[model samples]
Each structure stands twice: as structure tokens, then as C-alpha cells.
Target: MRVLLTGATGFVGRGLLERMSALVNLELIAAVRKPVSGFPENVTSHVIAGLEADTDWRKVLDGVEVVIHSAARVHVMHEQTSDPLAEFRKVNVDGTLSLARQAAAAGVRRFVFISSIKVNGEGTPVNVPYLADAQPAPADPYGISKIEAEKGLRALAAETGMEVVIIRPVLVYGPGVKANFLNMMRWLHKGVPLPFGAIHNRRSLVALDNLVDLIVTCIDHPAAANQTFLVSDGEDLSTTELLRRMGVALGKPARLLPVPSRLLEVGATILGKKALSQRLCGSLQVDISKTRELLNWTPPLSVDEALRKTAKHFLEQQSK
Candidate 1:
């Protein structure tokens, strides 16, 4: 099979490229914004700048069987654009639909889109996880754009007889993870006193390896066509348990203070960090039973094993 992967330099895309390149039966082509080095000899790199709605994909779409579309205007902490929604739509919704149209016309068999669990909503009721068929209730502009893009892809699939597989993953983490997951690891490594010991909210997360494996399966799996699936590690963790496990992986003490969840929320609100507090104390779980039942897939790596790899990489990078 011949596959074209976008965002080849990104965290998930890079991992996918490395793993897929090693397969003897597959030929890989990387669609990047600019020239990149260090890819395996078996992989070919093609440059297509901007990746916007007007960008032409005819040059690279020929003979491409599967296209894993991972490039997007990702979520930002502090959005600088005046119209954040418009900016996200320009790339995520418009650009994605444009590529799918051209890929369908070019005879591409399957297009796998990497979406976020945010499309299901920010948080879920306790023990009531978000399902793949739930009505989308996006809370942010990025999530809104992803849902819109998914809708467009489904419509295009119906019109063109092309297959569309959408995978919505929750909080992917691994060796090259950054942002909030990295910050938590840093805090645990430094032995900072955290007030999350009493929080019992559950959150689901996916390992990069596991997500990549699922992506590869969807690339050719007959049951995956025109389906929306939620991807996770099949294990949910509370904030306190997650910190404890990460601390063990990092070979450090968690040093957690048993502060009441309500007190912490009130303090955070007083300090104008309510959003941060909510992320730490809220529940956001996803149900992947549908994905497993449909594709007979399970995450290959356990949470502890994945975290150990993540911590080892973090320590190595810190030493450098």
C-alpha cells in the first residue's frame, strides 16, 4: 500500500512515519510544508506550502492510497488572531475539506483524520464517558472546527464513494509530549507540592504509539470505513493516581498535599486561575468500546510502560 502522511514533523506524525517506514509492504510519502531531513530512505518528502483552502494537492495525490491528515491549526493557549474561529476554519475545516475533495478525485481510497475529544465536549459526567455517536458539543473554536471538518469529510465521502475514518483521541502523550503533560512531569520531577491528592476526577489519555497503531489499522480495515471512533488506552486515571504513577516513572516522590477539591477550586478562582483548576479537578473520560468492538484493536502499551518511556525521554532531554 502507498500512504501519504501530512504533518510529518509533528509529534504523532513523526512517530507514525518512523513506524510505517519500517513495514516492508508499505510505501510512505511525507507531505511537509518545507524540506525536512532525517527521514528514512524508504520515505519520500513532498512540499506543499500553506496547506490552506486554495492550496493545490494534485501534485502529490497521484497514486496515494491512504492519506492521514494530521496537519491543523492546533489549539492555542493565548490566541493572537482577532478572529480565532475564522483562522481555525481556514485551515482545519476549509483546508481539510479541500484536500479530501482533491484526494477523492485523485482516487485516494481512504482519508483518516486526527480529531480531538474536545469535539465531544470539555468534560463528562462522572462515570458517563463520551461515546463515539454522541451529539457534538464543542466548547472551543478548535473543537468546533474539527466537528465541522468531520461533517464535511462525511459529506464528501458520500458524494465521491471515498472512505473517511475519523479518530478522536483524548490527550495524546508520549516521549515528545509537551504543554500540560510536560508541565506536570516537570513539577513531579522537581518534587513540587501539588494539591491534587484529594481530586478524584477521571480522565482518559492515549499514548502516541497506540494512536498510531489505530491509525494504521484504519488505513485499510474494512470495518473502519465511514466511521467515527474514539481512541484511548482503555484505562482511566484520576489526577492523584496519574501524578503518583508519573512520579514513580520519574523516580521521584509525588509530594502531594491532601487539599479539599472545593477549597482548591475556590482558591484558584480567587487567583484568576479557574480554568487551570477545572482542568486539574474535572472529569473527561471517553468510551472506546465501539472502536474495539468494530476493529478488534487494543492499545499495545499500558499506561505505566508509556509513562516510563515518556519520563526517560524527559530526563534525557533535561540532562542535555
Candidate 2:
């Protein structure tokens, strides 16, 4: 199979690129903005700079059987742009549709879109997990753009007979992870006491490897056509429990303070971090039964194993 992968240098993309390259039966084409170094023998590169509605994808879509699109303007916590939605739509929605249209024209078999759990809303009620077909309630511009892109892809699939698979993953973490996850690891390394003990919230997270595995599965699965999936490691954890696990993985004692959730929320609001507080003290569980039953797949790695790998990678990077 010939596959074209976008965002090949990104966190998840890099891992997928490496894993796909190891498959002898697959031919990989990486569509990246700039030149990348050290690709495997089975992988080739296609330089497609800026992503926009008019960005030509003729060359990149050539003879590509599957297109795994992982590139998008993700959450900009402190966005400086005036019209954030327009900016997100231009790249996430318009550019994505442009690629899908060109791929359909080029006779591509499948287009796998990597979406986020934010499309289902930031958090759910305590025991109510997000389902694949749940009504979309995007809470931010980035998530709204993803929902719009999903809508467009479904339309394109219906019109052109091109298979489109959507995977909504939650907090993908593993080697080469950055942003909030990285900061948490850093704080853990420093033995900082986190005030998440009293807060109980369930969050679903996927390992980078697990997410890539499911993406590969959706590439050719007949039942995956025009289907949406919610993927995770099949495990849910609270902020305090997650921190404790991280401590175990990092070989550190979990120095967590028993802070009240209300106090934390008020403090965060005063500090202009209401969103962060919600994330730390909210439930965002996903029900991946649809993904498991329809695709006949399960996460290959356990949560503890994934966390250990993540912690090891963090330590290695810090030592370097």
C-alpha cells in the first residue's frame, strides 16, 4: 500500500512515520513543510510548504492509497489573532477539505483524519463518557474547526465515494510529547507538590503508539469507511491518580497537596487560568467501545507501560 502522511515531523506524525516505515509491504510518502532528515528506506519526502485552501496537492496525492492527515492549528492557549475561528478554519477546515478533494480526484482509497476529543466538548458529566456519534459541542475555535472539517470530509466521501475515517483521540502522550504534558513531567522531576489530591476527575488518554496503531487499522478496514472512532488506552485516570502514576514511572514520590477543588478553581480564575483549572478538575472520559468492536482492535500497550515509556523518554531528553 502507498500512503501519504501529513505533519510527518510532528509529535504523533513522527512516531507514525517511523512505525509505517518499518512495514516492508508499505510505501510511505511524507508531506512536510520543510526538509526532514533520517527517513527510513521505505519512506520518501514531498515538500508542500504552507497549507491553505488553494495549496496545490497534485504531487502529494499522486498514487497515494491512504492519506493520514494529522496536521492542524491546534489549541493556541493564548491566541493573539483577532479572529481565531477564521484562522483555524482556514487551515484546519479549508486546507483539510482541499487535500481531501484532491485525494478523491486522484483516486485515493482512504483519508484518515486525526481529530480531538474537544469536538465532543471539554468535559462530560462524571459517569457519562463521550461516544463516537455524540452530538458535537466544540468549546473552542480549534475544536469547532475540526468539527467543520469532519462535516466537509463526510460530504466529500458521500459525493466522491472516497472512504473517510475520523479518529477522535484524547490527550495523546508518549515519547516526544510537549506542552502541558511536558511541563507536568518537568514539575515531577523537580519534586514539586501538586495540589490535585482532592480533585477527582476521569480523563481518557491515548498513547502515541496506540493512536498510530489505530490509524493504520483504519487505513484499509472496510467497516471504517465514513466512520468516526473515539480512541484511548482503554483506561481512565484522575489528575491525582495520573500524577501518582507518573511519579511511579519517574521513580519519584508523589508530593501532592490536598487542595480543595473550589479553592483551586477560584485561584485559577483569578489568575486567568479558568480553562486550565477545568482541565485539571473536570471529567473527560471517552467510550471507545465503537472503535474496539467495529475495528476489532484493542490498545496494544497497557497504561502503566505507556507511562513508563513516556517517563523514560522524558528523562532521556532531560539528560541530553
RMSD in angstroms between candidate 2 and the native structure over all alpha carbons? 0.9
C-alpha RMSD by candidate, in order: 0.9, 0.9
TM-score of each: 0.98, 0.98
Q: What is the C-alpha lDDT profile of model 2 across 1-320, one tens digit per residue?
A: 89999989889899999889888789999998998788887799989987799999998788899999999988886799999999999999999999999999999999999998889999998879999998999988989999999999999999999999999999999987898899998998999988888878898999999999999888889899999999999999999899999999999878999999889999999999998898898889999999999999999999999999999999999899
Off by over 4 Å in 1: none
Segments of candidate 2 deviating more than 4 angstroms: none
Q: How many residue pairs in model 2 have overlapping backbones?
A: 0
Candidate 1 is scored at a TM of 0.98
